[model samples]
Target: MKPLNITYIYDYANLQVEEVRGSNISLKNRLAKLEQALRNKDELAENLHVIDFEQLKIENQQLNEKIEERNEELHKLRKKTIVTVQIITHMREKVQFVQKEYQILKEELAQLDQDLGAQRDLVTKTKHERDEHRQEYASLKQQTGIMNSEHLTKDFKDRAERIKELKELITQLKKRHSQMSQFIKSHGGVI
Candidate 1:
């Protein structure tokens, strides 16, 4: 080996110093990129927190509206219940009044039935008496034909005139009974 050259060694030492400076600059660029990335992440997290708070506020407002609607519905239902109860009470009173009226009408009908029965009995008794009077008049007429003397004939004529008057009275009684029957029929009696 020959002796080392001083100029060559000086050139090699300068080359090594330039390479160290380049490496230090590259490392500084990488550190700056990392710092920028960290700042961007912090900004994103802050924006997300603000969005979540806004969403929570909106949900709270919706819940409050639903509660108010339910309270209004409950108040309306309570008013309707009170009105319904009052109507039922009025209907019950009306029913009681109608029942009382019906009972009074039933009692009146029973009394009318009793009156009609008495009237029918009176009509039947009057008919029986008229039939007995007719039989007696027939017997007296037969006896009058058996008499021959003038005095007896005169007495028989007078008795015959009396019987005719009695027949007229019986006819009038029959007319009155017919009028009473018509009256009872027109007044809703079961004659």
Candidate 2:
């Protein structure tokens, strides 16, 4: 974990780095002016050279430290940005995976819907076929009943006609039998 002080240091370093950059430009100008003075061998330039050189060295060292500190902060920030980018890439991949799964589920649902429709059609067709078969069976049953009834009626009529004829024949035979018996009685011989 980064210490909280590092955040303060980074902020301070950023401000100092900008100040040091501006100081560096001034330092360059002063150095240039010092060079010009030294070439002319000015007496005052000779007397203040050590003090000014020492002061320049101290400022240069401070500026270098500030630059180094700012570079360190930038390095940390770069690493954090890289990690953030990686995390973002991972999230994007997860989203794509979920999307693919969703597409597959949608396709499966569509197929199931089609299957359901087909099954419903099959059920309807089966019911229709079953009804047709029932109707055919009922028609055949009705025809069979009519044939049976007609046969029964014809048999009853034939039986009744035969019974009437037999009754007539029996009456005629009884009359003949009575006549024969009377004739025999009338011809009664005592001999």
Candidate 3:
């Protein structure tokens, strides 16, 4: 069927109304004209239905395009959310690693402090021992000095007594030799 044209139908209806206004028409001609108008009206009604159906199809297509656009946006959002979650998980892992390293360093620092304290204690004990040794050495030196002076005085006295005894023995030997020489001369024995 040919598509209905509104301008053509308006012109055709005006032409028919002008013809009907001439009231000298026969009954058969009027009946024929009414039947033709009725047929045009039914064709117009069918054409309006077709136009409405075409408009609904266009609107349906436009709605589908909007839904597609929204779906694409939703897909992009889901991808972005996944990437953000991955970044957050990586950051959490890094924070945990840093915390573990900090704990290890803290323990090492504590151990170092303990070692330093022990070294200080050892130094203090060594200083005390050194002081005690120095005092003992001083006391021993004073006692040794006194003992050496007494020994020297006793040796000098013993040497002076021995020299006196040797001088008396030499005088006795000289007196005996002079007496023997005089006796030989008095006896006339090769004096």
Q: All candidates' TM-scores? A: 0.39, 0.37, 0.36
> Which residue pairs overlap in candidate 3's backbone?
none
Per-residue lDDT tens digits of candidate 3, residues 139-180? 887888866576777987888888888778778877887888
Which candidate order results from sorting by TM-score in descending order? 1, 2, 3
**Candidate 1 TM-score, C-alpha based:** 0.39
Mark the 10 consecutive residues where model 3 has the least summed lDDT: 19-28
**Highest lDDT scorer:** 2
Model 2 misplacement above 4 A:
1-41, 115-191
Candidate 1 residue spans exceeding 4 A from truth: 1-52, 123-191
lDDT of 2 at 64: 98
lDDT of 2 by residue, 53-150 (tens): 99999999999999999999999999999999999999999999999999999999999999999999999999999999999988887888866577
Error of 1 at 80 (Å): 1.2
lDDT of 2: 0.91
